[model samples]
Target: MADTEPEKTAPQEHVHTSTDYPEGAQVEIPQGWMYRSRKLGPITFPWYASPQSQLVLVAFVCFLCPGMFNALGGLGGGGQVTAYVGDASNTALYSTFALVGFFAGTITNALGIRIALSFGGIGYCIYTSSYLCFDHTQNFGYSVFAGFFLGICAGVLWCAQGAIMMSYPPEHQKGRYIAVFWGIFNMGGVIGALIPLGQNIHTTSNSTVTDGTYIGFIVLTFLGACLAWTLCDAKKVIRSDGTRVILMQHPTWKSEFIGLWETLISDPWIICLWPMFFASNWFYTYQFNDVNLAQFNTRTRSLNNVLYWFFQIVGAVLSSFILDFPGMRRTTRAKVVWCSLVVLTFAIWGGGYAFQTTYTRAEVNKGANTPLDPSDDYVKMDWTSHGYIGPMFLFIFYGVYDAAWQTSIYWFMGATTNNSRKLANFAGFYKGIQSAGAAIIWRLDGLDAPPPYMNIFASCWALLAGGLIIAAPVLLMKIKDTVSVEEDVKFTDESVDDVVAHKIGHEAVDQEKV
Candidate 1:
């Protein structure tokens, strides 16, 4: 609920309800559709999870297969996910994610978030279960089966997530809500890491993961799918103030594309951020799944993931506090995100050192069955890898780094834009590009050593470059243009019918211009 009374305001519905909007005009949405405004400067960090965050959390937990076990599934049969059938599926996943995401607003608008969530959830179920069966049957068919659906699901669910994240919370709490939403759902990574540790603890090495382990993934996958069924669509969402947000855009295909084109042309940030956003997930996938998981021993890898999730939560929570820290200006808050993400990029490369610490060596070989030499600098195992202490500590630290980088992206995207429909489009665009990045690496999985050979530092730096690219364009643009002055004013001095009408998106206004 708005903390203050509804001041006399312009009919916000007029933004959307205007029959005169040109083709592809962005309709104004209910206030409930926008994120809550903060009294303080730019960031919206809450100390605790809001009840409203359950949607993101539930969606995330159900997303276990995509980021969690399936990512690890590559470790099966010596990085089967990257090296063999999974390579094809991984490409399909992102390609589909990008393709579907370009126009996912239509899907959500037509079918609603529930169906998209369910479809995405079911995709996870199929992908997770199919991967297990493929591994069991050595069938290429199931691998392809899983990737296609997962890609489509990623496109749909992500758009839904963006809509809900921006809309469900109040302005002040939006940042915090995003933090909690992401922090909780990321627990899937922790759970995924733990499951393999338990299932494969007795195994000789990172050989074929046990059938029972696949069964575990299957069960967890379905549990997540069930949760998806329970999720509500964004339009129907009940906001904090107990008002139901009416349905926004149910754009026709042509209108959606036109709107998307208009947005891309008008918003410089969207164009600049696209490359980085597209490649975002790929770096992590290659580093953690293809490289780290491929190289480490079972116990060490397991311990690494334990650290990954545990510290990730800490990082996410702590980073949120940084966002909400009292007295910080909006620029300072953004800088915090930028600097942290940049530093974390180095930390990703630091994984090489961590990988070196393990006694396991490159458990998987490069093509031609090249010997995985523990003594060679390339395959050399480090004391950190050898010792549980080093691996655990790194995971914890990486968690914070991961938390800072990942959560910042979500919050940053929402904070900058108040357009619920555009926000959904942004989310879809981000994920679609992310899929493209992942797909590139899936192709290299079959190789003995994926691109840039052994220079993990370079790889991490590349990811940092992407993060920097994402931040650079936004910061370079004048602060006022990106963060509407009127929107900021609404935080404290809410006037009757004046500030908010201008503060929120004006696609309908754009339509007038058109």
Candidate 2:
């Protein structure tokens, strides 16, 4: 019995080798699991490594393109009012533009990601450049045409860019990435505003148009081309084994569009978050119109431009760091958003009221000799008195709020999707909502008698703020991590040489058993 107990089977050994399977062969195992092997090419790092960086660069180019166009508007000021389609009212111009934008933007949204991004860039450059062809001699029809083209271009570009930004990186990193992305992107406003300050050497009398503006457009267009190329070249890595699996080609629109919509609507957080983002865009558009208000002030075009740039820069810089504070860092996304909404309301609506009141009071005390009319339908400021303080504070406040809103939206997107293509399409849909809303508001402002400027501002602020607050809890409730089945895979250097490698080590013994 003791001799029988000493008997033992020969030791068992399992040997694994790379050549165990032929190149490009498919491997199948028990329980319906399958693996494939293919050699992976060298990984090429994109110009912008992370999605945040890609988004920021894209946003930056977007901001710059508009800045040049907007700078033209800044230079025109209140003195040279161009009629669009026989409608001289600024509200009408904005309204007509918005109406066209809504339709075109919606179509763009439906086009999904790849088509939208590609066509959007090409159309944007073509349409934006067309603005340079206009002269004072042109009929209102040209203005309408310009507006139509501009609206379409802007609508498409924004929708595409937003979707692209949403598609990048880990969920937790979304906040930080978006904050940096938007902060840098919005800083383009400062860059755009500064161009006018430097180029203002040619007075209005020298030429109806400034030559520098043409040069600026060229530069902006070139930058856009560079950004588009970078975006197209961005690297996507799928971690398999302990190594990264590089996906070299861009995603197809057909494969991703429906999936993106499904992911967006399926999530509880995104449903609530979408409307809030829509509100954020409306407010951002309103900020651009502040130039209209500023025109009424005695400040020179150069001075106003300087102020605009200064405040934007300060605001963007400050907001970048402020949102990272530990107390603010991990705060519920809803609360952070609500806080930003409050600040935005105060800065845009409340600040506008305060400034108007200040101007009105000054005008009355001065016996109306100041040429300042509180009832006027123009934007005015006392540049000498404030020396950019008013606009600075206003922009800084806007920058802070805008940064927060962008961060929350991106974070929400990252949490909801594993596919970047889907992120890009959803970004399009979300931004389309923004452009559509802005177009309507802008047009309505054009239609109002005396434009009820103050009342309109107040009303928009109230509605947006109320909407955000009410939606906050619902938006952030039960923020959960998305299901990423790909996370279970691991990759090593040897495995990186091949697209597919499967093995179970001592560490994976328990995992495999389970």
Candidate 3:
């Protein structure tokens, strides 16, 4: 042929024969299949690589245990508060316990995932189970000790579980995962409320004193232990002696602690998230306290619990689904947060009005010397006339709003950040800030003042709402899209083959990386 160059020898295709593979290699579908699929892109929908069965099981167990425990604590707190009243020593003791929990969380954060989780679960089981021994006759010393131990356990459990959940799911899937887990967990609160209600009902039926509430705690503790075992089994490699030994090495220990500190201080996203998380905590704690306020106004403990459980279920379910909508996803995390804050403002204002009305009516009733029927609904100041409809509506609104905000924030955090170490550290810092906020609220309560409950509640809510509103715009402006790791790494035909080969060659490595 006129200018035909020597026949180009077909490029000799050299197969990659070396056994060595890139660290943390994952199996990927063939390029042909991926190219054919419309959704094949960097930010893969459904975030996680096909749901990890073991992880999902472990997560379910984790959710159940904490949910039950927290719910029980909510119920038990009222009784403990009543029992320890006017005991200055007990107040000091509660404070000390809370302080210990604060420190324990910091330590857990420094320890990394494996060690922290193992220790945390075991510790929680032991301390939480001890609740069975508590009673009205127990002195302030006992109450303090119980509270202290429980606090330590709770702190560790919270920190460890949070790290585990965040570590497992990719960023985009975080909202859905968190919402499902949290909804299940909050169900424990419902169960907890229900247990007491059941006990109350039984006591009413049998004409006996309400003495079997502790039984619920015992049952929950056992369930928690079983779940703890599952968690332990799920990650056997990390539990091995070799891993433990390596972690104890002085250099490793120092590196981990330093890394934790650095992560807390340097992360910009985490810094922005702290205030919002703090507000969330305040709102949650406030809700817990509202049960007592409801009881006081309605003079029926059963009504309070029933209303709470009802609203919590509704709110949790609604929030879970609503957050998944495209418009409300990661990009609108701040907007969700702001909406919660605004709703909280109205809720608290409504609560204050209710309180003021109750106070005025109480004074009138006291002056008149009439024997008040606790269950009477027609009293002008009775917020319970509608069976806590006012407070219930408020709680329902807050719960839904809170759920959406939490889902958005956590999802955004997990998706946007690539570093797992940093995510764990940020979680610790965020929780610590939450504890600090709770402490501030606790201190601000003028317990000695003349029924300043309404003022205290109103002021805190107003301030929290205002702070969130102010910060919302700033956070919204800073919000950005998440970058997918898959997108950044190019995938060619050969690369796809390599990935598939790697998975076949080393199943263990693929599992570990995923």
Candidate 4:
């Protein structure tokens, strides 16, 4: 059997100075059974074991898992009658997500990415089921409890995802890969949103989603878990150009923690981006509950949810082109994105502020002092009502803003390192901090005297502007054209230095110390 296998050959190195390496670099096809099984006459189908294939695999997994989760979340109040249960559930979910996410990489390294991912998928299933249980029994505690457990699972799963996404692609292709993954992941949201929109199309009253929607989410989420097991190990994944994806040998709990600590202390610039991380998921509460649920009836919320996720795909793809444009220098691209986000944040949030002034929770929900005049046209906004187009578009813009904001952050993190082990830690830190902010905001929203709607809107705007401002110096001055060999060698052991240094041409090896 061994003698019949195709012969393997040494892959020649193709060197370039910038992050974008030239296409068509020669690669010797591997002799392994997995690679050979995928071959045809002139073209090899996407081999299950290849990095590109694995990326596609992971993207689908996310599309099923978190993507579906996003759809449910985007339904405003998790498709519940009122926002309280959803708010409390999110508070529980993000609270534990913060703590576990910070150390999730350790679990990923110890158990391997597949196990972590499988564990991650479990949480979504439980969470959606809890909502189903709530629909039947009116037992909201189960939902909050499910949220707490899911948070832990999500931390590990997302950390694994970030490491794989950020490290799998060659330097210049990172942005494209992020966009592709994001587009697919958010598609889950689009499709999931459709489930509710179609099911409740006739529902004009304020109400919770039917049990069938939750069941659909649970089944899709379970399939994502099955997909997780199919992912090729990081070490075995070969890139299209036949370069080995970078990995640390013999990973252990001790080594993973040590590397995490070193990454934090050595790369102090990451601290500057904490505010940005904190602000990333902080606005979801306001967007979903305060705005969408507050303004629209059940059926209309479902329709708005679909548009939101669809625009997310649009925003992710658009940002990728700007970030990965072949003509511009990588550093120049970073600066341009920073400037654009600053402007976009102000413009979008300024519009959000204006929208918030028109209706308070009292006015929209028809609480005290709110007369239910038939001609008021301010309460219980339905999709068919007059003046619906403007608010709908504004909500869509918010979706785009979310996708671009998240894509830029991932791109920034990927710019700093190529080592998967080190990147795992970086990703963990990002999720942890982001979850921390989310937890605080979600908890606040659940409070009896929660901040006024305008105050919440204003805080989101202020934090976003401030986070971007804080991140500007690092984006402009610190990001390099490519990852330095020294940073890789210094963070990981010396074993990776030669391989990494050679992959990123010797001329560019020491260009940046980060």
Best model number under lDDT: 4
The list of candidate 1 runs beyond 4 A from truth reads 1-57, 60-82, 241-250, 347-388, 452-457, 476-514
On TM-score, the stronger of 3 and 4 is: 4
lDDT of 4 by residue, 65-165 (tens): 99999999998778986777888889999999999988998888778989999999989999989888977787878989999999999999999999999
C-alpha-based local distance difference test score of model 2:
0.45
**Per-model CA lDDT versus the true structure:** 0.56, 0.45, 0.45, 0.82
Worst 10 contiguous positions by lDDT, candidate 1: 505-514
Per-residue accuracy of model 2 over 116-141 as CA lDDT, tens digit each = 44454544444444445443343444
Encode model 3's per-residue lDDT on 313-357: one tens digit a residue. 565566555445556556675466457546756764566456444
Consecutive 10-residue window with the lowest summed lDDT within model 3: 239-248
Evaluated against the true structure, the overall lDDT of model 1 is: 0.56
Model number with the top TM-score: 4
Candidate 4: clashing pairs of residues:
none
Residue-level lDDT tens digits of model 1 in 145-177? 678878888688777776677655644566677
Deviation (Å) of 480 in candidate 3: 2.3
User: Deviation in angstroms for 460 in model 3?
Assistant: 2.9
Q: How many clashes in each structure?
A: 24, 17, 1, 0
TM-score of 1: 0.74
Ranking by TM-score: 4, 1, 3, 2
Q: TM-score each candidate.
A: 0.74, 0.67, 0.68, 0.88
lDDT of 3 at 433: 62
